[model samples]
Target chain A: MTTLTENPNVAATADTHHGPAKGLKRWLYTTNHKDIGSLYLWFAFIMFLIGGAMAMVIRAELFQPGLQIVDPHFFNQMTTVHGLIMVFGAVMPAFTGLANWMIPMMIGAPDMALPRMNNFSFWILPFAFLILIMTLFMEGGGPAFGWTFYAPLSTTYSSDTTALFVFSVHIMGISSIMGAINVIVTIWNMRAPGMTWMKMPLFVWTWFITAFLLIAVMPVLAGAVTMVLTDKFFGTSFFDAAGGGDPVMFQHIFWFFGHPEVYIMILPAFGVISAIVPTFARKPLFGYASMVYATASIALLSFVVWAHHMFTTGMPLFGELFFMYCTMLISVPTGVKVFNWVATLWRGSISFEVPMLFALAFIVLFTIGGFSGLMLAITPVDFQYHDTYFVVAHFHYVLVTGAVFSIIAAAYYWLPKWTGVMYDVTLAKAHFWCSLISVNLLFFPMHFVGLAGMPRRIPDYSLQFADFNQWISIGGFAFGLSQLIFLALLIKACRKQGKPVDAKVWDGAEGLEWEVASPAPYHTFSTPPKIK
Target chain B: MTRANLVLLRKLVLVVFGMFLFGFALVPLYDTFCEITGINGRIIVKAEDSDADKVVSDRRVKIQFLVKTDAKNEFDFKSNQKFIEVKIGELSEVSFEVKNKTSSLQLAQAVPSVSPGTASLYLNKTECFCFSQQILQANETVVYPMRFFIDEDLPEDISLLTLSYTLYQAQSVQASYSKSELDKGAS
Candidate 1:
C-alpha cells in the first residue's frame, strides 16, 4: 500500500501518463472521478426537469381548484411521482455527483478508493428510475398512493403497478447503499498525509457523516419496501389489522428511515454553505470545531426523533413527549450552525457573487423553514398541520431553498474549475433573483391555505382557497421557467465560449483544488499534494 | 481493498444487515412495548376465572360493545347489546351472535381491542370467544359468550370504555393448528 507524504513539489512526478478514452466508452468504462461526477450530475439534471414537469402538471390542475387540466386520479399520480423523483432521483444523485467531483480534489487524493464500484453505482440509477417511470404507462396507472405509500393504500387498495414501485425503490436503495459505501471508503482510506480529521475541509467532513447515515438508514428502507412487497403479493399480515398487525407500526418503521433521510439530503448542503460563506466573506470559518460537532449532533439526534412524524397516530402520551423533546433538541445544533454562518460574514469584506448571494439567501430562507419545522415539532399543533399544505410549505422551503439552492451555488462556485471558462455573471444573477422571488410566490401562500383547512393530495379545494392557489400556480410557472436561464448559462460555460479562468478562480478561495490548473486534469493528485 | 480496509467494509456491511433485521425485529418489539404500556388496547385472555373470588365495587362504569367482520368474511356478526353499565370488579357476561352464511365449512377468530387504550390493563377477560378459533359448518349460527370484568383499580376519570371485536377468516390459524396436530399424531 502507498502512503501520501507532505511534499509541495510532488507535481513533477505526478502521473498524467494517459488521456481519456473517446466517445461513449469514456463515460461507460472510465474510472476517473471527474468524468463519473459529470455523468451523475447530467443524469440528475434530466431527472430534475422531468420531475419539475410533473410539478407543472400539478400546478396547472390546482390553478382553478376544480381540476382544470388533469383528472383527480391523475393528479394524485403527479404528486406521488413528483415527490419520488425529486427526492431520490434529483436531489440525492446531485449531491453524490458533487461528492464525486469534489471530495478527492479537496482531500488531495488520487481517486476514490473503490473506482470500479463507483462506476457500478452510477449505472444502476437509470435502470431504477426507468422501472419507476414506466409504471405510469401501465394499465391501472402509476402509484396514486402518496409518496409515503402507507399500508393498505399501497397494498390491498393499490393498482397493479404497486409491485413495480416496490422493486424500483429496492433498486434505488441498492444504488444509494453502494454510492454511500464508496464515499465512506474513499474519505476514510484516501486523505493526504497531512490532512488529519480536523484539518480536512468542511465539505469532506459533512459527506463523511452523511455517508455513515446513508449506510445506517438505507437498509431500514429496504426492509420497509420488502414488507410492502410481501403484504401485497405473499399475503403477509405485516400491516393487516385483521391479521394481528397494526397499520401504525408501518409508520414507525418508515419514519425511522425517513427522518434520517431528511438529514442525508441537507447535511451536505451545510458543508457547501460552510465552504462558500467563508470564501465570500474573505475570512476563515467561524467556530469550525463547533460546526463539525453540531453536524454530528444533528445526525445523532435524527434517529431518536423519527416518531415526531407519527404524533397523530394515537401514540402513548409518554411516547409523544419523548419524540417531541428529541425533535426540538435538533434546533439547538441547527441554531449553532446558522449563527456560525452569520458570524463568519460579520465585519468582513463580503462579496455578492452568485454563490455568495445564494449562500446568504440560504441562511435566511432555510431558517424560515426551520422555524416552521419547530412549530410542526410541537405534537399538539402538528395535528392541525398534518397532511395539510402548511406541511407542504415547510418541507419545500427546506428542500428547494435549502438543499437545491446550495447545489446551484456549488455549481456556480466550481464551474470555472470544471470547464476552464467563467460563467455569465449577469445571467446567473438574473436567474437567482427570478428564483428567489418566484419560489416564495410558489410556496409562501401554502401556509395560509393549509392553516385554513386546505387538505393536501386533492385536486379540488373550496372557493375560499381559489385565489391563493392561482397565485401559487403562477409562481410555480415562473420558478420552472427561471431554471431555463440556468440551463443556458451552464451550456455556454461548458462549451468553453467564455474567457479562460486562472487556476484559482476566486481571489479568496483556498484549498488543494485551487492549486491545480483550471479545467482540472483528468487525473489529479497522481502523487498526493502536501498540506502544511 | 487492504486487509484492514476489507475488515472495516465487512463490519459496515454487517451493520447494514443488522439494521435490516432490526426493522423486522421492530414488529415483536412493538408488541412487547404495547403489552407493557397497554397503549394499543390489545387484551390478554385467561383460560379460567381466577379473579372470580375478588370483591365487587359499587362504582358503575359504562361499557360499550362493538362488533365488525372482515370485508372478505362471509359471516353475520353482532353484539347482543350496544351498551351496558357494569360495576367494577364484577364478572359480566356478554354474548355475540354469529352466522356463517357461506356454503362451505369455515373457521373464524375474533380479535378484541379496547378504547381509552390505557384502560386495557384494567379490563381483563377470564374467558373469551377470542381465545381460540371457532369452526362453523354451512349456515351454522351460534351465540359466543365472553366473561370479563373491570378491575376495582380502574381509574376514576374514565366513566366510559369501549370494547370492540373484529372477526377474520382463520385460514392461516387453521393451517398452523393442523400442522401442530399432525406433529402430535406423529409423536
Candidate 2:
C-alpha cells in the first residue's frame, strides 16, 4: 500500500497520520471532507429533532382545536420556527452533509476543491441557528409571521425580534452561497480523469444543478430579508402601501427565491432515488441522459413559474394564465423523471432493502405530492387552496415523505460504508415501516380537511375539523417518537457494535464510493482511480 | 486556493451580488409590471382630457367610493356619497370630508387603490387629493374634492368598481411636530 516512490505527493498526504484528529479539535480545525461531513450530519440530526419538537407543540395545541396548551402567538411562533428550522436547519444542511461526504468519494477526488471554505460554511450554520432559536426567549418572541413572512405581518405589526430573524437569515444565506460555490468548483475541477460529464453519477448531476439553483436564489433571499430589516428598523417603505410601496411586491420577491428553494430541497432527493432504485433493482438507471435533462428542465422552469404562488394576489387574467400554463408545464419534466424511475424498476430483480423500501415509497408518495401540486397550479382552483391545509398537506408530503425519506434512504444506503458494519436489518425495516405508515397518516388527511376549508397557520380551528385534526395530531406524535428508533440505530452502528462489512457493502451497488475500504480510509483516492 | 479558483470564486461572488441587487430591482420592476398590466389595481393617474366632447359612449358605471383611516391616525374621514352612477367618459366630482380630531395640527396623505383591478386603467383622475399631502389646522374640517371620469373602454363586464382611499399620518409631519414639542419642552 505504501507506493511512495510511485506518487510522492499522495504518499505524503496519505501517511499513517491520516485518521481524524483528536476529539473536538478534529471537528473545529479540520478541513477534511469526511469529518466535516459527519459534523454536518450530526448537527442536522439535532436540528431535525428540535424542529420536530416544535411541530409536536403545534400538534399538541391543535390536538382538540381550542388552544389547550399554548397561546395563539406562541403557536404562531412555533409554526414559523418549525418551518424555518426544517428548511434551513434540517433539510438543506442534511443534503449538504450528504454532498460533502459522498461527492468527493463518488468523483474519485481526494477532497472538496475549496476545503477551507467548506469548513467555514459548515461552522457558520450552528451560530445562525443559535441566534434564530434565541429569539423565542426574547421579549416580543420569535417571528410569528409564517415562514413566508409577508409584509406588515413581518414588519410594522411584528415584534422586536424581527431584526434578529432577518440577520439570522442573512448569515444562513451566506453559508449556503459559500457551500454552493464550493460544490460547483469541486465538481467542475475535481472529477477523475476518465469521468466525462455524461459518466457522472445521478447524485452528482442532480447536485450540480441544485448547486447552481442555490447560487442563483439564496442571494435573492438575502435581499428580501434585508428589505424586511429596513422596513422594520430603518425607514424604508419597500412593502408599505402608504409610502407608495405595495405589500404584494414582497410576495413576488420572496417566492422568486422561494419557489426555486423548494426545488433545491427536492432535486437532490431525485438524485438519491435515482441511485437507490438502480442498485436495488440490479439494473442500470433507465434513460439516465433523459433523467438529467428532466432535472435541468425542472430547475429552469422553476424560475418562470414563481407567480403561481401569487395567483390570488390580484394578477391580471393574462398574467394568471401565463403562470398557470408555465406551472402545468413543470409536470411534464417531473413526469419524465418519475417514469424513468419506474422504468428502471420494471421487471428487474428488485430487493426490498431498507434503502429500496424508502425509494419505492418515495416514487409513489412523491408522485402523490406532485399531483397535488399540479392541482394547485390551476389558477382558479388555487384561489380556494391558497392558504388552506390542502397546501400544507401538499408540501409536507413532498418534504416529509419525499425529501426526508430520501435522506433516510441515503443514510441506510451509506451507513455500512461509513461505519464498516452492517446495521440490524429487522430494526431498519421496522423503522421504515413505522415512518411510512405514520407519515401518510399525518399528511394525507390534511388534503381532506383542506378541501373542507380548514385554513393553515392558526392555533384553533372550527369544531367541524375536530375529528380529522385529532387523527393528524396523533399521527404527528407517532411519527415524532418513531424517529428516536432511527437515532438509537445510528448510534449503535457508529459505535461499531454490529457485524463487520466488506469494501463493497452491497451486492449490486456501483460507484467509486463502494470501491474503497469500509469505514472508508480517512483519505481515499490519494491517487485518482482510472475510470474504465 | 489557486489563482484560478480565486478568480472563479470572485466571479461567483459577483453573481451573488448581482442577484441581491436584482431583488431590490424587483421593486421597481414589479411597479412597472403592475402599472402596465393594472394587475394590482395601482393606477398612475395622468391628467386626461376632461373635455365634454371626449364622451364616446353612454354606458353608465356604478362607482362606489370608500374611505378608511389608519388606526394610528386621529382623523374623521368619510366619502360624501356611498355610490354614484356616472356615464363613461363624462367628468364627475366627488368629495370626502376630513376633520383633524387631534389637538395638534397634522398632515395626512391618502393612498388610493381601485378594485375589480382591471378597471384601474379605465378609471382616470384629472385631479385627486391623493396627488399631494393635505395639511389641516387643529380641529379643522374640510371637504376634499376628487375630479375623475371612467374611460369608454372600461371592461364591458365590469359595471361596478370600488375605489378606496386609506388616509395615513404623514411621517415627515409627525417627525417635525415631535421635534418642535421636544424643543418647546426644553425652552
Candidate 3:
C-alpha cells in the first residue's frame, strides 16, 4: 500500500503547500467545515461575552434592596434581552459549532452532507443578532416583556420595535433549523461504511437527537413569534381577550417549543460529557445502550411537560396535575444519565484534568439544578416559586452551571486534540475552581431570596433580601471575571506552545476521531474508516 | 435467502418501524394542530352595535359607544366624526364624559363591553384622558367617561349595547420609568 505522501491525496498535497494565508476571503467563501466551525465558535464566544455583560448589568441593578443602577423598565429589558441572546445566540450556536468541527471527524466523513446550507446557517446568525441588538435603539426600546414574551405584555403594551424582535427571531429560527438539518443529514447519510449505528460515538448520537429536536421545535417557535407580530401590528387577535382569544394560550404555544429548546442546549452536552468522562476515567461508559435510550426518552418527555411553566397561570386542577406528573417523569431518564456518569468514574483512574474537573463540577452542580427543577415541577411548590428568584436561580444553575459548564469542559477536553498541543493545565484548573465556586456563590442565594417572597424580573426588592443580593452580586462579578482566564487559556492553546499531544491523548478513547492524527486535517478519512 | 437479502429485510423492518413510530408521534401534534388552527372547539364573540343606552346613575348620565355599522349617529359624543361602525367586524371603543360636580374626591373605572369586561390597557389616573378613573381632589370638578370604538369587524343584525362604570377608591399598579429611577445611583 502506498503511503499518504507517496499517493499524494488532497490532504497530503495541501500539507506540502502553504496554501492561502488566512485572510478575509478564507473566512467569507470557505467551504472547509473546520474553518467554518471555528468562525461559528468565535462568533458565539463574542455573543456570550455580550450577553454576560448584560447579565452583569442585571446583577448590578439587583445588588441592593432598591433599584441602584437602572430603572425597573430597563432592568426588565436587560433580563429579556439576556435570555434571548444566551438561548438563541450563544449556547445553541456553540454546540452547533462543536458539532460541525467534530461530527465529521468522529463519523469519518469528509465534510457535512449539505456544506453550502451549513455556510448559509453560520452567516445568518450575525445578521439576525444585529437586527435583535439594533432593536434596543428603536423607539420605546427593545422588548421589555420577559423572554417568554407572554401575551398582553408582548402584545397590547409592547414597544413599536416588537416587529423587529419578531423578524429577528424568525431569522434565528431559520438558521437553527438549517444547521440542524445539515447535522442530521450528514450523520444519517454520510457516516463512513461499517460505522454502524450502535457503534457510533455518544456525541454523534446525542447530537443526532438534538438536531431532530431543533428541526421539530424551531418551526413552532417561528410560528409563535409570527403570531406575536401579527397580533401586535397586523391587528390579529390570536392573543387578544377582546377578540375571544386568551392571552395565556401564547404561553402554551411558546413553552411547547421552549421546553424542548432547553433540551436542545444540553443533549449535545450530555454527548460531550459521556465521551469525555469515560476517556478520563479509563472506563467504558457504564450502560452505554441505556444512555442512548435515556436521551431519546428525555427528548420525548420534553414535549408533554411544557405546561409546567404555565401552572400558576391558572389551569384547571386536572391540567395542572397532568403537567406536573409529566414534568416529573423526565427525571427518570435524566437520573439514569447522571447515574451512568458517576458510575463511569467509580474506582477508575480518576484524574482531575481540566476537562474532567469541569465535568465533575457539572455533575454535582447540574444535579443540584435538576433537584431544584424537580421541586419546581411540583405545581403546589411552583406556585410559591413561580416568577421568583428561585425559578431564576434554578434555571441559571441548569443553564449556566449545567450547559455552560459542559461547553467549557468540552472546549478544554478537545483543545489539545484540536490544536495538537496541550493547554496550560494549571491555569485551566484555576479557571475551573474559580468558576465552580463563584457560580454557586452567585446562584445559591437566589433560592433563599425567592423563598422569602421576592418575585423575579424586579429591579428592587424589600430590605430583607439585601444581604443575599450583595453576596450574589459579588459572586456574579467574580464568575464573569473568571471567564477572562478561560479566554486567555484558549488564546495560549491556539498558539500551540504546550506539550505535543498524541493522536489519542486519553488511554481509553474508543472513537474513530482518536484513531486519526492529532490537529486533524483540512480533510480526513475521505475514503471512510472501518468501524470494527 | 442470502446474507444480503437478510440485511435488506432487516433494513425494511426498521424503516417500517420508524414510520410507525413517527406516525404515533404525530397523533398528539395533529390534535394540537386542530386546536391551534380552530378545527376544533373554537368560540368566537362578536359585537352588534345598535344604539347607545343612556343610563342614568345617581344624578348623572353616560352614553355607551355603538358598535353597529348601520346605527346612523345614535350617540352624541364629541368624537363622533372618528366613530365609524361596521356590520360584522372588530369591537370598537367609545366613551362619554360625566362631571363630578360635587366638591368631593370622585373615583371611577371606565367599564366597557361586559362580555370581555374591562379595557386591557393599564388605567392611569390622569386628570383628563377620557372616561378612565378621574379622582378629583375636593372642590375640584373632573370629567369621567370612556374613549373607545367598536372593533370594525363586528357581526351584523344584533343591535343592543350597555356601558357600565363603578365609582370606587383607586390604588395604583402602574409601573412607569421615572427619570429619577432611571438616573438612580448614577451620581
Best by lDDT: 2
Question: Candidate 3: which stretches are off by over 4 Å?
Answer: A1-21, B1-187
Residue B171 accuracy (lDDT) in model 1: 80
> Whose TM-score is greatest here?
2
Q: Residue-wise lDDT of candidate 1 within A1-532, one digit each (tens)?
A: 0001101111232344466665577677978788788878878888998999999999999999675688888899999999999999999999999999999999999888778888998988999899999999899899999888889889878898998999899888888888888888888888999999999889999999999999999998999989989878877777876566778888988999999999999999999999999999999999999999999999999999999988888877888899999999999999999999999999989999999999999999999999999999999999999989999999999999999999999999998898888889999999999999999999999999999989999999999999999999999999999999998887778767688888899999988999988878777888889899
Where does candidate 2 clash, by residue pair? none
Global local distance difference test of model 3:
0.73
The residue-by-residue lDDT of candidate 3 on A1-532, one tens digit each, is 0011111112343454643235466566767677677777777888898899999999898777776688887888899999999999989988998999899999998888778778888888999999989988777999999888998899888898899899999899888887887787778777889888888899999999998788778877777787788778776656653333446677777887889999999999899899889988988999999999999999999989998998876554667899999999999999999999999999888887888888988899999999999999999989899989999899999999989999998898877777778889888988988998999999999999899989998888889998999999999999999999988887777766688788887777778878767776666776888777
For model 3, residues B50-101, the per-residue Cα lDDT tens digits are 2433222222112233322111221112323333332222223434344444
Interface RMSD of 1: 2.8
Give the residue spans of candidate 2 off by over 4 A. A1-14, B49-53, B172-187
lDDT, each prediction: 0.87, 0.88, 0.73
Best by DockQ: 1
Candidate 1: list runs displaced more than 4 Å: A1-16, B45-55, B172-187
By TM-score: ranked, best first: 2, 1, 3
Tell me the lDDT of model 3 at A3. 10
Q: Which tens-of-lDDT digit does each residue in A1-532 have in candidate 2? A: 1111111111223555766555466677879888778778888889999999999999999899686899999999999999999999999999999999999999999899899999999999999999999999999999999999999899989998999999899988999899899988888888999989999999999999999999999999999999999878877788887666778899999999999999999999999999999999999999999999999999999999999999988887888999999999999999999999999999988999999999999999999999999999999899999999999999999999899999999999998888778888888988998998899889999999999999999899999999999999999999998899898888778767689888888898899999988877778888899898
Q: Listing every candidate in turn, what is its Cα RMSD in Å to the true structure after a full C-alpha superposition?
A: 4.5, 5.3, 12.8
